[model samples]
Target: MSSRRRLGARWRRHRPLRTRLAVAASAAVALVAVGVCTAAFFVIRYELYHQLDLNLTQSATLVIQQHRGEAPGVLAGECRFQSAPACAQVVPADPAKDPGKGYLLPVSPPVRQVAVGARNGYFTNITLPSGEPARMFTQRIGLQDKSLQVALRSDAVRKGVGQAAGLLSGVGAAGVLLAAALGYWVSRTGLAPVARLTATAEHIAATRDPSHRIELPPGPPDKEDEVTRLAASFNTMLGELEQSVTAQRRLVADASHELRTPLTALRTNAELLARADRLTPAQRDRASAALGRQIREVSVLVNDLIDLARDEEPTPLLEEVRLAPLLAHTVDTARTHWPATPFELDLSDASATLPGVPARLARLISNLLDNAAKFSPAGAPVEVVLLAGELTVRDHGPGIAPADLPHVFDRFYRAEQARALPGSGLGLAMARQIARAHGADLTAHQAPGGGALFRLTLPSEGGPG
Candidate 1:
């Protein structure tokens, strides 16, 4: 049983959708046709037999009425050896007086038994001595001493029923064939969209092109079908895939370009250190420090590249986090990292909360603070403000150039003024990515007091935790 079920399942799966649909429709139509045809054939056969039985009964009645005044034995004598359209027979009720002569249809024991037992006329089916089918009616004739039997041949009825049944069978077969052909046409028409979808998917797969998309046929806007929905979903998925591929390519190209300068500086520094005896102690110390700084720079750049590359990672765990405490912590950490640049905090008393991943939010705050501190002049204060779910960081330094303001958040984008800064340009880019992931926005502009201001805004209402 299990093996048979498995085989059926395999057959269904391997079968084409159009073929399956056609077969299913055809089978349903055939079943209904067979049932209706079979019922009609049986009804026709019953009606034919009923009509034949009525005619035989009427003939028997007519013969009795015609000989109403005759003696019981005289009626038997009249039918003796007579060949009529319908066969007739008579038997004497009195056994001793019975002539025992044969007539057109000889009375059998079964017919006599029926006549003896019956109070009135009764009909039955029988086969005559000649091996032909007939219907017989038996009853008493003029008196109690005699009985009569009348029979009609049923060969014609049988032939008519047989022909009708054959005709019904032929019609049923024709109907089934027509139903199958119609089902095939309907299935092909209905599944045309699916066929097109399959072809497009195969082409994309073979060519390894994520840019390929399915175009929907023009139809009524209100008539949204499964095929249309599926095509739309496929196109959306392809668009996302294309964007991801483009981002990946851009990351590789940018990383390669960014690594060249530090790598070259490291090589130069290493050569100078290799000639230790030819250099002064101060020069050797400087060379070693420069090499170490270059290594740290390269390490930071590599780490930033990895962080940016993981664009498809699952979203980090989010929880309702209080902005005040997290921002304070980030500022304290930034102060430890950049002791020369003082950070002044101006936080609101109102507690601001939002749904966010704690670590990512912290990283975003740290990057904004670090960016401000890096551009600020020595001994200048970097102001940090948190109010009404919005955080603003301002640095007292030369503001960003107007042309560079738009692309400050772009990956690996360093403006002409800040190109000499010792940091990978991925900080602002990663900050913006994290902000977007947490359903917030980050923007940069010139501050009121001739410095750059970066503002981070969070939704006033919390999102899913």
Candidate 2:
């Protein structure tokens, strides 16, 4: 049994989807067909038997009534002894006497079991003396000494039932065939979309093309089904994949370009150090310092690239962060890093708590402060303001160019005037990425007075009370 089940399961798994669907539908239809056919066959059989029994009862009653006034021997003359239409017999109460030649009925054990005083007529199966199958009913006549039996030939009833059974069997076979054909048609029509989807997926897999999309034909809105939704989801996934691939290519190209300058500088400085014996002590120190600066810049750039690439990693741990204290700590750290640059803070008393990763949010604030300080003139104070749920930073240096405003947050982007600055251009970009990861928005615009203003807006759920 277990082996058979395993074989059946393996067969089902290997079957095509459409064939399975057709088979399942056919099985369901076949079950209903079988039930209806069997019920109809039995009902027809029962009705045929009921009609035969009714005729036998009427014939038996008539025989008993007709012979009520006459002698029991009189009924023997009414029916022919060997006729197919009717046959009669008189069984005497005394078992010793035999019912003679006029009796056509074969005295079977069932007929002999009938009692003389039975109010309802007794029915039994009997064979006629002429060797035909018949249905017989026995009833007591007015004379107490004899019982009358009447029988009709059952050959016609048997023939009719046999014909009907054959007809039903044929109809049942036709119904099963029709059900199979209908199931095939239904499976084909219903799974048409699935077939198309499979073909499209196979084509994409073979060609390694993300640009190909599944396009369903236009149909009524009410007709939208699961297959349609699945196709739509597939197209959406393809679109995202295409965008990711394009972004990765761009990142590689830009990173190569950015690393080229620092790498060239390091090589030049190292060449100078190789000829250190021929150089003056001061010249050697200058070359060594330049090399150190280049090395630091490369390290910072590489770290920035790593951070940007990992922006889409799994979500970080979240906790309620108090914006006020976090901003104060970031300002102090920035002040320590650039002691020559003074920092001014204009913070409101309203305390805001936001759900975010503490380390990430701190990095975001530090980046904004560092960007402001990098562009600020020596001794110029960088201004920080936190009111409601918005944090703003302004640097009183060369403001961003109008054309450069849109691209400021783009990775490795720098304006003509800012290209020679001592920093990689990933600060604002990383800050914005962090902000977005925390469900916040960061934007840069020219301050009304004379510098660039960067605003970070937290979501309402994280806003001040």
Candidate 3:
């Protein structure tokens, strides 16, 4: 069970991006380096061994020339030697005849025997006369009149080559260790800027401060490096986020300021109306009505503020709602409130359905109609049309100037000439918030017929068109 758990944990670790990348990079570099080093090491060893074999063949030829014409065929065990310990000790001066050829045998204790076969040369390791490790090489020669064979013991050369290989292996291991260390350090150095950027971004997220930006290290201004470009992009995002957050905070503060004034007025008007016994009935009624109207206006503004703030929370409550009936109710309410203005409704389908927040969606429609009625000339027609999930409200009044259109939804941004108008300048902003909450879209434009037109598009679930 413990082994199974360990395997499961390993699988989980292998699934992550950073772990996988590091493992793959390290394994690939190590494998390639080791493979190339091993190949080169073996190639050099093979070539050195081959050269040693060639030297052995040359030595055999020289020995044959020195012993030429001495014997047609001599047994290897009967050969005598006086000097040249390295040459005479390993190979007999004569060789025994075998299969029409003579093969040399070493008479020394370094090797018990040696026979030069007719095949390729090879080395055989054995104990020497001194009881030490030794190797023998055999070479055969066919002369014009007699065939000769020689054997050589090269214990020193074998030991030297073996030591060289061992040393090379040790060096290779050290090199692999050094390379791994250097590669890790280089990787860290190359990714240090990325790490810094990631750390800064994490700090900003924890603090919820969009003003925090990464400080780039001093270097040559190379924009081509990915790390440098990423740092620059992160800084740019912070700037934009700072501006957007500042704007939102300002909007909320301004909205609060706008609400405070209307609330103060409503409270004052209500207080005055409370002392109604001292005034005539007409005066009392007039004050009460004014207070009521002001209270209603204040209520609407507060609701608008709530609507605007709701946009900060993600995942609004959604429901499938019929569009035509909601529009009908909104228009009816508008007609009742502004009886002086003629209201018209032209819906393309009687049962158009869409996914949205029902209450916010209704409030958006109502706000558009209210805004149109307020701006339209008295007794003028306020046209309301719904076609293909798009609702357009147009008022036959002095349309908004093109320059002011862009700032229409800005909270409390009343036009210079329209500051005295009834609205606190948050209606359009509220309408836009509700539209966004429902995953729909809203825009304002000047109607071709010389009036302000507001178009509200309820996007399909497929996405915005």
lDDT of 2 by residue, 247-269 (tens): 77778889999999999999999
lDDT of 1 by residue, 287-326 (tens): 9999998899899889788888876223667678888898
lDDT of each residue in 244-310, candidate 3, tens digit only? 8998899778977887887888888778877887889998888888888888888877866676665
| C-alpha TM-scores of all predictions | 0.75, 0.81, 0.67
Scored against the true structure, residue 237 in model 1 reaches a CA lDDT of 90
In TM-score terms, candidate 1 sits at: 0.75
Better of 1 and 2 by TM-score: 2
Which regions of candidate 1 fall more than 4 Å away from where they truly are?
A: 1-22, 32-36, 50-99, 102-156, 220-222, 312-321, 336-342, 354-358, 374-383, 394-410, 414-422, 436-465
Ranking by lDDT: 1, 2, 3
Q: Give the best candidate by lDDT.
A: 1
Candidate 2: residue 243 Cα off by (Å):
3.0
Task: Report lDDT per candidate.
Answer: 0.80, 0.79, 0.69
> Which residue window of length 10 is worst by lDDT in model 1?
76-85
